[model samples]
Target: MRPGVSLRTKIYGLVITIAVIAFACSLWLSIDNTRTYLNEQMQSHAQDTATSLGLSISPYMDGNSPMVVETMVAAIFDSGYYLSMVLTDADGRELLTLENPVEIDGVPAWFIRYFPIQAPTQLTDINNGWQMTGQLAVTSNPGSSHDKLWRNARNNGYLSVFIGGVALALAHLILSSVLLPLHQLEQQAMAVTHKQFATITPLPSTRELNTVTQAMNSMVTNLQTSFTQMAMHAEKLSSDAFIDPLTKLGNRRAFENQFIAQVGEMQDNDLATLGLIQLPSLQVINAKLGYEAGNGYIRQASEVISQALAHRTSGTLYRTGGSCFFFKVASAGATVEELCNHLHEQFSALYSSHYSEGFANIIATSYDNKQQLNPLVSQLDNLLTRESSTTGTGLVYWAPEQESQLQHANGLHQWGEIIDDLLASNQVTFMFQPVLACEGNQTSENVLYFELFSQFLQDGIPLANSELYAMAELLNKSLELDKMLLQQLLTIGDFKRDVTVALNITHQTVHSAEFGEWLEEFYQHNASNLPTLVLEISETAILASIDSSIRFIQQVKACGIQVCIERFGSSFTSFKYLRGLDVDYLKIDGSYISDLDENPGNTHVIQAASQVGHGVGVKVLATHVENETSLRLLEELACDGVQGNFIQPTKKLAPYSEKKQCQYWPI
Candidate 1:
């Protein structure tokens, strides 16, 4: 049979086994000791009783009756020590008999069976005179001994249970205390594996556990630092791979990625519009003014284009090539013609006045249908070639009829081939627009304000600024353009007087540490001769690189240069950023100022902006003031200055006193 076992049963069995073995040895020893002592007492009691009875019976045998012997025996039995007593004659026949009984208390039969103790009886023979006449016998009761044995056994069993329980409780408490730290360590390891990097502040109680925790913390800290560094390096590499180093604008690779994504989205959603603009005379301009001016034009154009597209809630602009650019727009069901007209008006007005003679030849092509981009691009090429044959005047949209001509023009890739030649020649030129002060207390202190502008030279003639910038962006030479423009401005020595000349700074240039270092060197060389220069930055550019822009501004300020925020209100909610930047001027966007008199909304906006600017200690300059009325309104609103067609056209740099002496319009 399988061994019978249960927790209680096993415990009982073990206890019983141990107890039985112990009790057997103990009982044997105790019983031997008890037997020896009890026997001696019993023998002594028997001898005493027998001797007394014999002495009394001897009198009876000599002269008394049998009753007298019986009385003596009864007296001895009544003493309670003997179980039985007998008196006999010389022939050993019973003469008198007596019996003794004893009662046991406080003991069970089981106790007695578990630990039975017995004492042997003793017998003695007595003789009258010389012969044995009778036998005397005495027996002792063991009730007291049995009761004592039972009580001792029960006490031992209880003691055994108490000792086992105490041992179990102590064992459990010790085990838990020893293993608790290991459990905590396991949890911390899991957290680190999941990138939590949580610290273990509570040290383990044991020295070995504390050592392990310290080692883990050190390893995790190192790994976390390394991982962060690796991630930053990877991000830098990825950005470099897809960005144009010069323009800091998205390059052809970036354009392609965006183009594919937009096209796929448009195809799936059927809600987007695509537009492309190609600057036809970029090469000619780059050739005339040098690559630096060419790059300046591109940077300027990119900023303007980006600003224009941003006005539309959901549109993105991309520099696709040296002379080509792309845009994606969510039309919100607006007609292509309406969009095109709006773009045409904005581009024409902005570029014509700044670029002079070169504005007339630039072209913009747009495609709105999701299924017609390829055909549209082809048609645009044809239109460009046809226009080139003629005067290259105004904008053109692709029509179905141009398909045949597009096929013919497909073989001509002249635009790309001329770029290198154009860059090799110094064909770019810089221009300036005067930002006239509108305040009534005007003094001829030669405090003339001007904004930087650029153009591309074509066939010894200038190309429009927009066209040049678009081309530079496409060629991935925006930084080069900016550098060239700055060089040309310095070469012209227009900033010799105590005037403020504002130059546009791109986010790409501002973010580049190398560019910053180069700028420091340039300023060091021109420190004594430099005018009170003001660097103008767009809100969009600032938002894109807030930290770098702030750092650049600080560096420029350290060089004694002023910083202004251009197109300030274009980013409607970006005014909050002004609190963090140290800016001297806020140039209000022309869009909000164009119809200020007619549009209460526009007037309210300008008024509110003026208050905000003055509140923050920044001077406000209103742009695109077209007539006497707008100028008067700007002055009424306490605008610090104004710049527009209505203001005096920018003249060649003259002595500081002479330029400030002439007032184009009397306020």
Candidate 2:
């Protein structure tokens, strides 16, 4: 638990400690044996000299020849082994004595003191002719023993160091090789904590380590797969939460959700346009021709309204009432006069041809951004009352005084302030709704991915994705807005505890090179995130430039991002786009999803679209699913996923920054 210590260092220290202990024991034994050997040898040498001199002196004593004895003692003493020799007569008189000072050069005094070799002495008595002789004593020199002992220790010291050095080197090499795989596993595990998955290649020689490595690799792979599946399911569950079921348009809840999202970008100079199309006699027709016939007419009219508004800069068609359809238009350039013209002609045709006795009239008005919605709705209602009293068939009315006050998103300068404020503050959040799969478990807990709608917070109100994105497209700032949203999302790196994110890209970004480059850089910087980032584009834009979109989407995919086309099948040319473009998910247009089980026409197209999507390995998901019946029908048609109000509603969630990162490390 100590700081700044690693496993390798501990191993190294342990090995060196054991080596030091073993060598010290060996050195002590070596020095002890050498000292003992030298001491015995010295003793033996002294004894030999004393015995030799004693016998020679005995003969000298018997003859009473001291000179001879002295001469013999001197001869023996000259040898380096003997340090001193002494011989005497029988009466204890000294007959002969030889002494020599001994010094062993090149041996330090400290070495001798620390590694002392004691000199040995031996004694003998000389006796001749029954008379007692003097004793002869010899001393052996120990300097030679000390020198030998020093040489032996020096050699042993060098050998011990050499052996220890080589041992440490070999130990380090083997230890490093063994621990390398473990280190890689640790790195891989850390990356996974951040929701990134990477494979490791380790071929260990040891059986246990090799097994551990293989197990770690398999664990990482499984974690990655599970995370991907979770992300997809959560995305489906989230998308189904808000989308309306009947008209294939955002229901009242979805509209309010979008409206709240757009409120943030509302400025004093901004305009909010609301228009209603009323069919008063539709209820009468329903009573006479039956509810089935009435419902068919409403469905047909809803489709036409959505189609008409599809080509416009930005608008959402909503079924607000039993016999009414409305449009929510917010722009700075001009009113949706073109859309009204298309409406008048279509309604005029139905009326002039006498398609039915039901009369339809369109009324539109624009209000300054500061006005509240209640007053606007009231004003529109008063206008409809006038229509009910004065006109019967096809009629178009505009608020006489407010038409001139309309403004469109005409210039960058006009929107520069609002956009800049959003960018600077990053005052935006995404509302996520669950998109459930029809054929699978429909629990929100099991969903892994959620579809996101970006809302920018302005003046204490959040602007919905529709308005924020629509205006961005109108001002040609769609690419910039996309980049900004991406940056913001990256800041919220974690989602659903290791989930993949499906982000919707506006049309301008899908076609812009600038956005492409920005996306590439963003992915590269966030590669560690292994975000499982999925980019979604609408079929409306992809159909226009299938080839270019295919190329751009491929480029993004090459950067390790997933691509999908939202609102698929807007054109029957689904075959054309599906043929050339590579996509992962095809979100079937909501209209086809509404009452899919009941409408044979919608079912036929759904089946065909699902087949084509599956043929290309793309998943087909029906959005705006409202009832269990429609969900069951889509499942029967082989829908990969289903998202709508029937599954779950859109909900706000805790921001990613506040959540904990996933931890999947093995204990």
Candidate 3:
């Protein structure tokens, strides 16, 4: 793009040009008219002097009064108006002569050279008693006339310049006032590009500019309305698929998704605690006081547990069944026994106040490490039922073994030290999983990019990447960990030259100003050797600090990096917020893609997500496509890409050379 001159400057130039020309013409005309008038007056004065002196000299025409004539001529010449005078006899012989040199003061020599004044001479015949004796000539000096014209021209020039300067300054002020609205309109348009809509207030009074301002305001209003509607529709679809309608919590589907993604796979020495709350008197309460009463009880219980979970960031509450609520908290916080006991106290208070004869129960259990999702929930349910049958409600119980408690504490302590060492060492291991494009009926040979997963090792044992992040977050080491991951990824020369790579970033990293500044500098220095880098942020992380995340995404994208929102649709946060984001891809959470062929509800959710993404010109991708049916389903739903075991399992990222191209999955 070429540089543009401002309207103000252009107008100023035009006004100045016109003013200069007009002033020059006006000054020239004034000086010309004054000079003509001065010449006429000088001529009239010289003629009058000559005629009067001729009569006076006529008496001396016979040579007897020559002295008198000479005296009169000399007296007139001495008046400084006439340059010279001569008296002659009737026979044309010279009689008396008077002459004076012409000189002018207070005017420049150059001015005289450029503008010369013309002088007129007058002649009369001298007569004595009706006889012509001699002739008299009177010539005017042009020095005084030139001096007068120069003074007038100089004064007029000064006045014109002062007036022109004042006019220009006033014109500048007027132009700035007139174009103020245009500047506002420009800023408004730029704001819209960043998804910030601002309207102009106190509209400009100019007819044309006012019309334009109104039009811009109307257009912004329409866009904001449309963007809001699109977001709301997408959010509704997300809620329908995963949210429990009555309790406003995660439904069974949401719970299953959360379990598989976060809880199903656990690390050694990491505790997994599950809590189940059952409203045992729900049916009896409904029979006596109606379903509304039963709903009230359920809502009350959900509220109690919701409030308890609020104090713990890692806790997740779900309405897994009609009368059963499930929750999970991180291992580093309050033990399972304390949580269960506290809930029991709350439940006991509710039972005493609302249902004097009815009862409720709470049961919980903790495993030392990873366990099957179904068996764990079933075991908790069986324990709750056995307790209710034996003790008859109002009971709070837990699994007998508390061995996981000590192991979890020890593991947390070990993790803190290990994470500090890893951060200090500035190293990490990376595994690459390919995200391949989805083309209908054809196995796509094209690899969209490779997503990187980071892991930490302790004494040759691979620790859970998820737990490491959890611990890092707890210890405020998330920023350091993310930095190490990016630094390590950049060392792989093969990926930089041949393909793209996507790396996950934590919420802490996304919000940290230090991290943002570091990333910007890193990209600037390594841009040439950098791959088509894509930063993958979780859907929840963005929703947590939406404004900052948007800034971060925009900042990185300006540096030529791509962004993806991974684990999308897992959170019930309205998808409307996506309209405000500038993203390249939306990686649908694996839970939604896992049973795509069987889960009809998730199909609608994914379809809505795909439509929303495409609406904003972003590609939608499905994660964890483990089977042919799911892959076919995703393709039918218009998913642009897919990633999971169906394509290829994650493998260690190895160093490569320029001669050998990186291997891709089978087409």
Candidate 4:
């Protein structure tokens, strides 16, 4: 029964048990002493009474005065101390006797029965001039003695009970103070195991308990530090293991991990796809452009591919080799045809613009119908081999005619026509999401600016910007589309003054060296009418070719326009480029923002990234800050800015107004 009792209860119980035993002993001694002393007193009283009554009667015995002796007995009995008095002659003849039953008042009968007080009886001879006449016996009544015994025992018992109760209460109070620290220690241990890393302050006054608690605080601090470092190192190991050494894209090994993991998780009602884009001309490009230039071009092309597929949260891109890239998309937003077209449109033009003769091919395979990845991978292998041999120069979207690559050129032409029609309209839509300052900049005056999210209108509906960028790549009009968006922004008359807006740019816009030269000349003419503009790209884009990204960043920064990498850590990023690239901000991926507080894995990663970013003078901001809890946690992690629904809702794309009288604010 006591097994489930708490430690505090057990401590109090032990103290109470000892107190009860001591109380019992003390009460018994008090009762026993009172009884013994009472019994001796009673015996003395009986002897004195018998001797006095016998001497008084001896005078009467000498004269044979029976009436006098009887009178004397009556006097003694009426005194109320004796129970009875008896008398007899020398020859043993019966004599007159006086007796009465003794009854003590107030004391209970049961008490007397349990703790009986037996008084001694005494006998004396009544003598006449040295001759014995008769004997008298006197027995003292024990009623008074019994009453005193019970009163003494009960008073001592009551005192013992009161003292025991007080002692138990005091012991419990003391134990509570002593064991309070133990309760805290238990809680602290549980919290530490869960990675909370909490500490207990104000050590217990008990010397031993204080020492233990202090030690615990030190241990918990060390353990928390160790856990955080371990998490960072583990994340680093996973990332470094999966990333390509040169391009920083997911390596072949990473692709295999994602492939198998997705295959195991794919359900019958799942949408998963595989794609492979191979640059069969990497060696030729390297020979034409130096090996370093060739590696840079590969990285640039990878950036375009990654940006095109950024809409897929569960998909991954891998640089299988210097000339080949592979991707396995999960829960694709578009069809296999659309993916192939997008990849082709983005990378083919990018390759052509970089090398003397551009060459790239794309093959997209749908794995939803296939039950396993092994067969899908085999199919991709066959397509790559076929593309390397005789596939047409442009995009080969998977068509009904599987054996021939050019059989799908007709579909590609149709997509090209759609993109042509969309661009001809010249209408662009733009959205704004405020990048809230994390370091106490709340008011409009303190806000840095809103990030401008722009898209091209197609079929009377605004498609995502990546779609437009991808299509523009295939049509060789991506630079024209980017310029058109900037032209529309420059023409905005109602845009608030003293407020800056940042634009997220595409890889194709900057891949062509001619675009950088063109932008440098175009800005000289248009910089006067443009608002404060900050162009943004993804880390994947910059990592593609640092040389190109750096050249483009410097060209734009020279025009008084800043550059940033949005969704920063989604790809494999290296800090070495920070020294060369002049980026103003690094926006962390949203995936990490949503998981903070609940799991410190993202926190540790963000902390490590921010530390590095800060050391290089680049401000770190987090995107997708959902709630106050997440926002507060990011603040604690020392982020410079945050953007999400919690910070500000994204505004609808406002159409460009051409009529209002306005001078575009100074860039």
Candidate 5:
């Protein structure tokens, strides 16, 4: 209806219209030309045949014979060119007539009718004397011409349809190729916006598409780099906020968070063993050594302590203060004594060689199931005060004696006040007993030694070592107590002779980096001033953290310190562990040596232990040598050293200058 329309629709309509018009025009031109040519040919043939027939039939007409006329007409029709022929006289009556029709092959009747060819009819008048006589007619068949025209038109129509179909298919393929790259670019852009950083795939030949892909790839790379920088910045911030810059350990806040979490887990699992180790002499160490040395020691001690507790079942270590560290362990079903013994063994091995003098006073508290954390902590504080009074040489545990002392107290607050005062002021006393060489009745090497024993208040009031230790444990201040006692000894006691001072170590004290650093510095400064120190660890302590203890011992041994395992063979079987420990001495348990002569079994056990120690190149010292019989049996068993009431009596520190050698003291 409209002159101008959509190109696609117009193209379609125009193509159809042009094709139809072309077909119609071709049909008309072909049919007209064919029909005209055929009609002319037929007309010519009919005229020639009629003229010849008329000439031939002239003689017959002159003779007025019907047979002659019929013969002539038949001859013209038999020529195969004419369909009908007729001859007649001038009176308008027929003289002779011949009819013949042709059959065409492979032509439809409707096609023939649609494109029919008309042949011209010929007429002749026969005259006797130049007047009107008769008419002649001749017609020819044109079926072959009509059939040729129909076939030509069909062939041309099929050719037009084939060309049109091919053009349509090619157009669709070309359009698809042009739009495909655009679709791909769109998808890539969407992915980048969502932070996918996906790489763009190669696109087809469009110039604009290639440019877009290159731009997108560049943007993705830049964004990835930016993200990496941001992540690094965030990590730095997080470390600075939550970590201790000095020791690289978790700060108080972080430790508290972790502690609460670990406690919850321990409670949920129904674990029972909780112990604390306090460093009672860190302030003394720091004062003696520079702050740098102190910090180094703290760092080293923290590392060692962390390593010791590394294998602890559901436990974590915290750097609680400048010199304090704390840890908690769930015995995972072990008895209170068993857990304490285990801790003592493990920690003893760790610090036994490092700081022999400083480590001797490390105290630990173990609480039974019935004890709560608060009361146990109070008890440990009291024990520490009692031990600190004496020159700080012994490790205290929670025992019945401590509980009895607490029961006699006026009240919980009063006990706390008294304990606090004892802790603040050095209201404690220490008694040192010498460790003599076992070669002869005469002293071989003057190794001035002492075992720490605690006395509270003005040095006469006895405090239960076990109760004080338990109170420290409850307070989670074992490290603090250990450091305090060590500091007290270093500040108050005099060490000027060639002596091997032995001290106890707790698990927390052994693992402290601060302690480790202090030991290193102390050894360096006192290389010429102090005696060759020996550190004694309880066998029970060494077994709790064997690997950590081994490492700690090795480090301390490297610094020229001596290591010893005390109270050996007292707890569960630990002979196997003894073989692996690098120790200079093994002190036999007092229970095994108290009456060696009366008990052959005790003598046999002592003989076996002495043999084992000698085999490993370790010297065996017998403790609690009270009577002459016990001392004689120890000598017979090849004991290396002896310490007991029969050997010597405890003396005041000042009298050591006058009485250089100690004779056997009667009990």
Candidate 6:
């Protein structure tokens, strides 16, 4: 295809060319007509002079008084109107002649040469009472005629130029107006290429362009609809795989899957709290009040538990069994006591209002990442069984453990002090986990980038981000902590080269205008020393403050940093949000990737996520890819990247200059 000129430019050029030609033709005609009229006037003046002079001098032409004739002709010639005048005797003897050289003033020589004016000479006979003498000839000077012609042509030329200029301006505006819609359509088309679909408004008035715009709009609408449906399907697959149909909570499978993932991924200092709520007489209720009533009671229990867990982060609720509902959360002692108290009140009310012989038993426990799931579940089961055998309605109970450990571990004030001390002393470090791109059967040692996990050191032990961020939020020091971590990351000189790092941010930081401003300024000064930076905002954080997240992403992207939607598929929201966010990567949450090959439904969910992410040009990455089976599954699903223990365990962040390839990468 050949390079094409814009319609607007072509039209403007044509209009200008035609205007110039028309202006030239019009000026030429006006000057030519004026020149002809002035020549006729000059001829008339010369003829009148000659006739008057010849009649007057005719009476004195009797072969004498030659001086009188000469004086009369010389007088007219001296008036500077005539170029020359002459008188002759009857026998054509010697005559007196008067003449002056022609010279025009106030006109260029080129103008006079280009537009020549003819100076007509008039002749009349001098008769002495019917005896004619020689002729009297008079010629007019062309200076005045040439000057008039030049003035008329110049004035006409100036007026034509002004009119042409106005015409060209109006043509330019009209062409721009006519082509404005086309420009919008071109932008729309380009946006589609980038997987962004949009419609143009205020369609062009031109019939042809309007039809074309309508067609374009239709095409965009169809594409948008297809993508929306694709995303919705992906979301539905994710929901179906993880969600329990009865309570709309995570099922046992999801809980166990995510439980293993969280334990492996969580820091040693992080605390995990678990609770089990059992409706002891659910079978009896089903036999007595019908299965519908049993289902209704189960739903009521789920709702009550959900209400108790409100406003809490990192909490997961699961319908582990027909009569067993469970929850695991990263929270402190005060939160666990609150949850138990709330459940106690709600269950007591349900028992008094709806049941006569039935009660709910609640048992809870707290531990660090070291505890295995089987022992914790066994302990909770034993406690609940003991409580169910003999208890008041809806009894709140806790498994026996070391009081000093729970107090020391779950104390909010202690965590606050520890966080303050950590920030004060700048005791912050990061663990960089390499994300490797998928290459089918080919194994490459190259890394896509490393995700930075912030760790706060307390007594030489690394504190989990969940714990640090929770304490920071309670102390209203989230922005300070985030800024410190970002500053620390930026100060690393080793990040100046081929290294790329993604830093996870909290919901508070995502919505903090001050943080945004500080980040922009900091990046401006230290951009050269920075690696390829990506701000990872969790899927839940984006949903929590969507507009703010969008603004923050755009703002940071303007500074040349990329963004990633981390923990994707953890939330059951529509994929439509991805349309509004200009993100570079989507990190599919680890739960879906854990034991991926064992669960067939998770395959479709991951496939759907991959489709949606790739549809919008976003790279799809799997987290917690722990085994060869899971890794192979992710590769088969066409995932763009994978990061987990199987790839490389999180290690202390070191300069890439010191270690080009981590130990995990095959040589």
User: Which prediction has the highest lDDT against the true structure?
Assistant: 6
Each candidate structure's TM-score, on Cα atoms with residue i matched to residue i, is 0.39, 0.45, 0.67, 0.44, 0.37, 0.74
Model 1, span 1-667: residue lDDT tens = 2244534445546655765676566656655565456556766767777766665566457435777877777876786667777666666677777776666778876765655555435555555577555666666666655555555555655665565456545744654564566656666665554234555677777788789978887876765555445434433543454456555665665555444433432212133445666554456668887778767767766776677665443456667668676666543222333455666666566564335333322233433225545575566566756765656554444333322322112111333333344466656654456787755633122334777555556577544333233334434455665666566656566454466677887545666677667778888897666566788887767877777887877787767778888866543442445544667888986655655555434555566677666645678888777677777778878888888656755443444555564454111
Clashes of 1: 21
Best-matching candidate per TM-score: 6
Q: Give the distance in Å from residue 503's predicted Cα in candidate 3 to where it truly belongs.
A: 2.8
- Per-residue C-alpha lDDT of model 6 across residues 284-391, encoded as one tens digit per residue: 888999999999989988887887775565666789779999888665455566677778777767775456555576877766768788998998897777767755
Candidate 3 TM-score versus the reference: 0.67
Put down candidate 2 lDDT per residue, 7-100, tens digits, no spaces: 7668778888899999988998999999999999989878887887777667667656757877777777777777777665556676666777
Question: How do the residues 197-223 of candidate 4 rate in per-residue lDDT, one tens digit apiece?
Answer: 678988899999999999999998876
Ranking by TM-score: 6, 3, 2, 4, 1, 5
> For candidate 5, what is the lDDT?
0.59
Residue 117, model 2: lDDT of: 81
Regions more than 4 Å wrong, model 6: 1-165, 190-196, 200-215, 357-359, 389-414, 439-446, 458-461, 496-498, 656-667
Please give the ranking of all candidate structures by lDDT, highest first, separated by commas.
Answer: 6, 3, 4, 2, 5, 1
lDDT of 3 by residue, 347-385 (tens): 777776457444557887765445667898888888888
| Cα error, candidate 5, residue 52 (Å) | 99
Q: Judge candidate 4 at residue 546 and give its lDDT.
A: 77
Q: Write the per-residue lDDT of candidate 5 for residues 1-667, one digit (tens) a residue.
A: 2245544555557656766677678767866776677778878887887777676666557646877678667765776666777777777677766776667678777877777777568886665566555677777766555566667666655765576567656754765575566556656565543233556666577787678767777876665555444434433443444356776665554454333333322211133333455554466666787778667767766776666555442344556567666555443221334444555565456554334345323345533334555565566656666765766545444445332333233233444555676678766655556676777533344433555544455244555443344444444444565656555555544565554566666556555557666777866765665445677776756776777777777667767888888867643242556544678888876756665555545566677667666655678888777778888888877888888767775544444445555552111
Angstrom error at residue 208, model 1? 54
State, as a TM-score between 0 and 1, how close model 6 is to the true structure: 0.74
- Candidate 2 stretches with Cα past 4 Å from truth are 1-311, 315-334, 337-413, 437-448, 572-574, 597-601, 655-667
Instruction: Compute the lDDT of residue 334 as modeled in candidate 3.
Output: 34
In order, the Cα lDDT scores of the candidates are: 0.59, 0.67, 0.77, 0.68, 0.59, 0.79
